[model samples]
Target: RPSRPASRRDDALYRKADFPWYGLDAAYTGPRWLMQAAVAGDGAVEHGSLGHGEEPSVRTEGGADKER
Candidate 1:
């Protein structure tokens, strides 16, 4: 079966930001991806996170949920 052509919008997972993005460190170089970017009111990135290496996994802590 023929598949539909991929569009630029479909391929775009991350939004454009004015700030520079970096990995964990200079020594560690691996697969990198844009996680998220925090944009200020003036349209400037305050801080953001860039994912590298393996994707993180979710793990519950504090021995399950407890009413506080």
Candidate 2:
């Protein structure tokens, strides 16, 4: 296996680019920031959601997402 990325930004970038493939077998749409909200400062927080397949439909709990 390749060596891990050495920097936080690089790792985050790597994950951002690579995360989608993590779902290739699960019929999932993401490891994406499914919900994000601004915090009090210049910072923000996000929550990610992964979808497992349920034939004929794609759904997310909390009604947070719908397929386009």
Candidate 3:
């Protein structure tokens, strides 16, 4: 039997955008940058978020009010 193909990186699957991407606003400047993005089927930017400070660690919190 043949071996399975290697998986691609998460960033490799990200789509490119022509428009500028901003984090928060012009006044608030901190250690924030482009984390990831979500695009439509037509390759349009639907929505995304910016990462602040340090990289987040994965954790499971069993609560309705807890943030994902």
- Please give the clash total of every predicted structure, in order: 0, 0, 0
- lDDT over C-alpha atoms for residue 60 of model 2: 55
Task: For candidate 3, write residues 1-68 as lDDT tens digits.
Answer: 00122124323323355455555566654555445567789976666655665545763465467566
lDDT of 2 by residue, 1-68 (tens): 01322355434433453234233454444333222222334332222333233322444566656678
Alpha-carbon runs more than 4 Å astray in model 3 = 1-15, 24-33, 59-68
lDDT tens readout by residue for model 1, 1-68: 00123244322323445445555565555656555556678865676665565666864565679989
**How good is model 3 by TM-score?**
0.43
Whole-structure CA lDDT of model 1:
0.50
How would you order the candidates by TM-score, starting with the best? 1, 3, 2
Task: Show the lowest summed lDDT stretch of 10 residues, model 3.
Answer: 1-10
* lDDT (CA) per prediction: 0.50, 0.34, 0.49
Error of 1 at 22 (Å): 6.1
Off by over 4 Å in 1: 1-23, 55-68
For model 2 the TM-score comes to 0.22
> How well does each candidate superpose onto the true structure, as a TM-score?
0.44, 0.22, 0.43
lDDT of 3 at 9: 32
Candidate achieving higher TM-score, 1 or 3: 1
